[model samples]
Target chain A: MKKLSRNQTFMLITIPVLVLFFVFNTLPLIKGFMYSFTNFKGFGSYDMVGIRNYTDLFTDARVGKSYLFTFKFAVLATIVTNVIGLLLALGLNGKIRAKSALRGIYFVPRILGGLVVGYIFGYIFTYILPALGLGSSMLSSTKTAWIAIVIVAAWQAIAQTTLIYISGLQTVPADVYEAGAIDGATGWIQFKELTFPLIIPFFSINLVLSMKDFLMVFDQIMALTKGGPAQSTESISYLIYQNGITGGQFGFQSANAVIFFIVIVAISVFQLNFTSKKEEQL
Target chain B: MNKKNKVAATTNWPVTILLILGCLTVIFPLYMALVIALKKPSEMTNDIAGALSLPKSWSLENFSEAMRVTDFWHSLGYSIMITVVTVVLAILIHSLAGYAIGRCMAKSKFYKFSYLYIVSGMFVPFAILMMPLVKQTAQMGIDNWFGVILCYLVFYMPMNIMLYTGYLKNIPIALEEAATIDGATTWSTYWKVIFPIMKPMHATVAVLTALGTWNDVMTPLVIMSGTGANTLPLAQLTFQTQFGTNYNLAFASYLLALIPILIFYLVCQKQIINGVVNGAVK
Candidate 1:
């Protein structure tokens, strides 16, 4: 058999994958953009509405509330998970017995499905916590419902972030700590001066990943609260999913989704730029 | 080295204490789930302290009942099938494409541009595509298991491709050149030479894809809803309402869903952690 040319080989390899990608990935994106400008209700013929959905998004209360809740949840969850994860990573990285076993235990939550974790915690918040006199169901109130979501989200999310931080921590050479110890710097001071600066890249990665992931929080909200009590914990992804796909607000939700897409991109890019600059300074 | 030895010899009591506490927090929920799932509903007193106690009988009744109510085996079958197929296909197809693009992009602008085009999908959130995708899949008569698998493949493509391509960079072209000099065709060279060499990356992609597919709720919920078919996560959500007051059954079902991934994690904890860190850092 004759050997194929480089371009021929490349085309042979990529054509099928690219076609499938375009059909499943790119087409929906393009269609979503087009539908955002229309009055399509996910079925039947519809006329283009010419920015009506986008305009309505500006004045929409539920949309605004969902965005607020999502951002608030993302920020809180990011901080909570990163702090806890970093601390846990620090502990795990220390000289310890059965270190791998401990690391495996901490990572359990990362492997479980989000919906399952949410449901387990849903029962906890509703029954166990209240029974423990923590308070009446955290999922029952608008004010505190988001807190439950954050706790559950962080519980699962911290697993990976902690692992990432541990990886980051391992990259710090023991000699640096030795140098600090010789200078009489103790634990906290050594960490602050020697360890922290070296791990900024990992910290930034965790921050950006956690932020992006939590921004699109959906499964946990569904299993825990279903965007209740009174849509208080409804994330942007949940809103788009529940309202757009199931509620026949296809075009409207597509508009929201497009904006959501832009916001995520902007935030990711901004965070990357911000963190990269900080990394350089260090 | 003396300082390091002294630090290591002390056992780091504070860090050890922190790790133990963190371990407690991590293990607490799983223990609660297990305890709750093993008990009868009648044994679950309204008081939290009572619920925290070990089950009096330690029966698998709730597990059996949960299996009946949730159609647990059916959903488990679907989850396994979907995850297996998606992981297998993702590894094979993405590796091939990655090999082509990773190898040829330097010499071919088209391949480089294609690489960018494909990877740019990474930035587009699934939210933007959810509604249109539902319509597209429905119109294509594939809004079922096949469609769900296809979505997973495409959804995971950008990241998998990126990872594979990056991994391929470390593999010397001399191997492929040697194969060619031995009169191996492109296909033969890829399969005989490149494929085996990419095992580590294949494992990374498989593990990541399997975890994502098995744990995903949103995609299956969007595509497979109303079709009477359910992945494990979707099945859990579907029965959430029915499991309303039956906390034991709910916990039992949650435990049932958790078992497979839990086992997978146990077997591959180190690789999973390294794969996640590799994916994140790259």
Candidate 2:
């Protein structure tokens, strides 16, 4: 065998992975961008229509509605999940008995697939809620369906967020709380100044992650509402999937997708920057 | 501090009760699945309490039927295969690239560019590439398990590489330098001297990738569509759609899909939770 230099050996091992990344990941992104400008509808040849797909997106009400619903859902889900998760972490972080088992119970839902959670919650919304005299099935109308979607998404995500928060809580030195107590800081005050500031990074992580996930929500929507009740809960991901795969409007959906990608990237970058700046400021 | 502990040890009962109730509420949807899955078909219609009602007679018939209809064992095997292969290969590839980037290739221009290229992928949002990915995979004659696994490998690479690279950066180069002085090849130095030290990152990467692959629906939905090689999620989707009204079987399928992952999580809960916390904190 030839004696390969260190750099050469590094290149040899890394190239295959890089090639696979390029072909499957980068290439699709590039092709998706290219296809957005054309009338390409699956196979065969197509002419580039310049910015027609892009311009047409403005006229697409479903895409707009999906974005609106997705943003609303993302915000609601993120807030609910983080708040509930933080509360759970705070409670579990204390010297509770069977704390590990309780923590495990809290995180159990996260291990289930989103699709499965959606279906399970769908069952609850459709049958149990009505039977319990909680009015009609929440999924029967646009407004209520969006609530169900948010609830299911939060349910699916809360466990992981709680776990993250618990870890963050565990990191704050016990002395910090002891000193706060000695200085006559109440429980709420201590949490605000000590626990909250120390765990801000974990908060940012959960916030950004939940927002991104909720915006791209698809499988759950598919299982729960199927974006029904007049497509009230069609998230960006579901909208793109519907338009591209089921509706055969690949080009138009690709345009929506490209815009969606830009929006998500912008949001993520902005969130990280904003949060990190806050972390430093605090 | 003594007062706080005394309060936590005594007057916290109500709050602890509330926490238990809250945790129960969070996990209620999953409990619903198990309840419905255990009920017989006749009981499902008559159970007025719905998800809250315990089955008068618990049976495994629904499970067996769900297993038969959804091809649960086959799909489980397929999902396991895909997750295992993708996770193992991704870790190996990412570690090699990460090792190179964090060590020998640290000062190279390619490393700088490649670092930004790979990490930028974390924000690209796979929805943007969905349509093109579907077409590209079909065109490549790999719209099957191979294609799905390949997509997972590519989609997951950036995060895995980021983790491995960041972890490797903290280790001193002295060990590798000593190995080099002993005339060991670059490859052996990584495998023998460096790889073993990456146990924690490996744990993080493994848990992260494994959970992602096992729970992912969109990629498999797009890539494996009509290929008749369904993973567990896809199989459950098909089962639900086909048996739209059969709540018994649907919930059973959902539970069947959930059991393996639940077992896995329970077994590796500590490691997985630690991995997630470490991934976020770092």
Candidate 3:
């Protein structure tokens, strides 16, 4: 048997993965990009629509509404989940009784599948909460739909984010908080000066991850309201999904997917740059 | 609420109160799921608020019945098969890719290309290419368990690879070098020396993958959007179709859906806590 050099063997293994990635991801990406430029319905050729598709997507009221909803969800869920998660993490990571059990309890929702979360929460919203006269449909009303989605997302996310925050919080030198306490700076001053600044890196990573997951969430939306009452909960990803699958507007949906990809990448880069620049200025 | 006994002067009280409330918040929904699942239909309808308060009567009928309606046993069987296979495959493939990337850091071209490609691929929304992938998978005759597993393999790769790569970087190369000096072959070195060392990491990866795959809905929902696909999430689709509006049964199923992962969560709380505490999580 001819023993391949480490580099040769490494390439042999990874090249196939890269190739598969191209087949599954990169090629499809190219196809998506191309479709965004055309009026292809899904299958074969169509009118070479140029940038009209992009123009239409922005100008169209429905598409824009979904984008607005998505932004609201991503931004809100991102903030709330991180804040609550961080709070939980800090609380639990400290010397506490039954921290393990508490951690387990906090994480139960995170362990659930999105569909199950949607269904279970949908039940609570539609059946349980409404029995107390909360709302007719937890997913139907516009204001309430966003709120419901946020609450549910937060619930599922608390455990995971808390876990991140716990690590971040624990990693902060105990002497910092202790020094603050000794100096009578242990209150909001301590958190602002010590905890907040220290955990920023965790916050950024968690924020990005939370945003990514929130942007991609579909199952909960589908199972919860199917983006309804009156399409009030229709997120950008869901819109693409509806167009692609149920409507079979493959080309249109694919175009939206490509656009979504570009927007996310732009947003991520923008976030990183903005935060890093802010840090430099600080 | 008081000035002298302010929140800061407290010893973890603020955190403790929030922890109590947070634990209750998670428990309430979980309790609702379980109690309602076990309660008789008549009892549930008559006294849901009471049933939710505590288990008035516990039995497996609701579970079995919901299972019957949703093809519960068959669907779970399918789900278990898919999730188990996918988890195994994810650990194996991701470890290899991660090791290669970690050891071959000087392989700049490969690293650069992968960094650009994999991270970029993450932002590639699935909607656009669902059409092509659906077509491709159908063409490849991977339209069953094989199709689902392949989709999971692709879905899971980027994140796991990212994680493994990061983790492998943290380990010292001298550890592996010492093994090599002791006449250890590459395979044995990885298997006996490196693999054992990577256990905590493996546990983290396993928990994440298993939990994530079990919770996934969109992949199977879209891929097997056919009747009889019966993934756990698909079975949770009781609300979508015009049916009995069996909210109670749906909640029953939702509760049941959580059991497997909840068990895993309970079992691995320590590992998960350490993983989170050690900064090993997503």
Candidate 4:
């Protein structure tokens, strides 16, 4: 009955997990990087043309459009979801009647599969809205279709984001608000001075999270628009799906995906540094 | 004192009104889905503003039709199986690794290395893994439910590990020490003492992971692309596409796909909301 050392016990538990991650995540990532430089058709090997796929990706107008659209969607989704989520959290965290029920109602969509929500909204845009004499269907236009996509993403995303904000709001000491009131600070002043600063951490979490999620937005786009209106609404992730899965340009999309990965990692690092610095000053 | 009361009363009404209006907008699309899902097919043939109004005759026929068209029960079963297996297995493994890092290896280099490794997965968008992962899975002869589940485990490991590690860090070491003094083995102590304390975090992780695995489309889309394997989301997407003109059946299938999750959410809304908050604000 020899007792294992602390590090031995830890390694015993974590080794299998580490192996699974290595095989399933990191190894494939390295392979994906390697494949980007080759002409591999997903399976059978081909010549390694160094950086040709990267050069091709840089010149591809459609891929560039998809990147632009994904960025636009992610930025807008982050802002809208955070603002609305914060507002909901503020209102519902107070002494509202049936607060629990309202929160439940608001969160219903969050639990739903994005495909379902997209299909429901797709029906609304293509059929119901037109039937209501709302002029032309929004999906027929590039601009309005993107707005619809953002709206659906926000509707579902706000549920979890609001809950995060509520948690953040709960952390603010009651006495802080009470003290603000004594000094005649109330309404917007109280929120701007006290609430906003405290919830900034939650704001960053929701921002980066929703931003990342929105950048990879796939299910809803697949169900709703399928990147319609002449492929104007295609997101980067969806484009990768299209190119890699359907188009069978695995090597080329691999190049696009590697670039996407680098951009995301850079953004996340920059965001964390920027927000943590602000959090400190606050 | 009089002025303060007046201000409070006036401000409360506007905020309340604003919240109500916002909630209505949020709920409008869901309400529309319900309306369409309930309407009789015959009654839907020539309706305009009827899309906005309540159904004249409600029936369960559309649901039955949807079920028939999409093999709804089979897909539902598949979705449940995948979600349950992925979430339960992923949680078990992630918590083990998280606990090892949190408790036994806190000061070890392995802890820092594993933590950084797991967190790095969060920033690497799934796009990067799509092409090569597919090839890797094919080479490994794992393009089935097992492969999809494994993919989910790898993809979700980072966040799940983060949640469990953060949770385990807070659990007092005194409890484990007492168990050791009572002659409990390490595994026994974890199962009896530490595991019980982790129930709240377990609930949080379970709800979050369950919802994510159930709603995901991309993983299954790639893994099961040519396999004809359909989860509920995939079923809905394909059904909608095949029957693009059939709004009644499409909406009904959408409802069928969402109903299970919607019910689960209603049952566990409180836990899920708290879970999201706890998972984030750490």
Kindly list the per-residue Cα lDDT of model 3 for residues B1-282, writing each as its tens digit: 235335445456656777878788888877777777776666755334654755566677767777777777777888899889988887887777777766775667766677556656666667666766776766677656678787777766777777777777778988878987887666557778766777777777776777767777767766676545767777777434622665557667776677776776677777755654443334
DockQ of every candidate structure: 0.73, 0.67, 0.49, 0.63
- DockQ score for model 2, please? 0.67
Q: Candidate 2 has which clashing residue pairs, if any?
A: none
Instruction: Give every collision pair in model 4.
Output: none
In CAPRI terms, where does candidate 3 land?
medium
TM-score of chain A of 1: 0.97
| Candidate 4: stretches off by over 4 Å | A1-7, A43-45, B1-11, B45-47
- Evaluate candidate 2 and give its CAPRI docking class based on DockQ: medium
True contacts kept of 3: 0.56
Model 1 stretches astray by more than 4 angstroms: A1-3, B1-8
Number of the candidate with higher DockQ, 1 or 4: 1
The digit string of per-residue lDDT tens for model 1 on B175-234 reads: 999988888788889999999999988888988898899999999988988689888889
Q: For model 2, what is the alpha-carbon lDDT of residue A281?
A: 91
Could you arrange the candidates by lDDT from highest to lowest? 1, 2, 4, 3
DockQ of 1: 0.73
Stretches of candidate 3 exceeding 4 Å from the true structure = A38-48, A278-282, B1-18, B45-56, B175-188, B238-243, B273-282
| Span of 10 residues, lowest total lDDT, candidate 2 chain A | A93-102
Alpha-carbon shift of residue A126 in model 4 (angstroms) = 1.9
| lDDT tens digits, residue span B117-204, model 4 | 8867888888888877887888898987779999999888898888888888788899888988988777777788887788888888
The DockQ for candidate 3, computed on C-alphas, is: 0.49
Name the docking class for model 4: medium
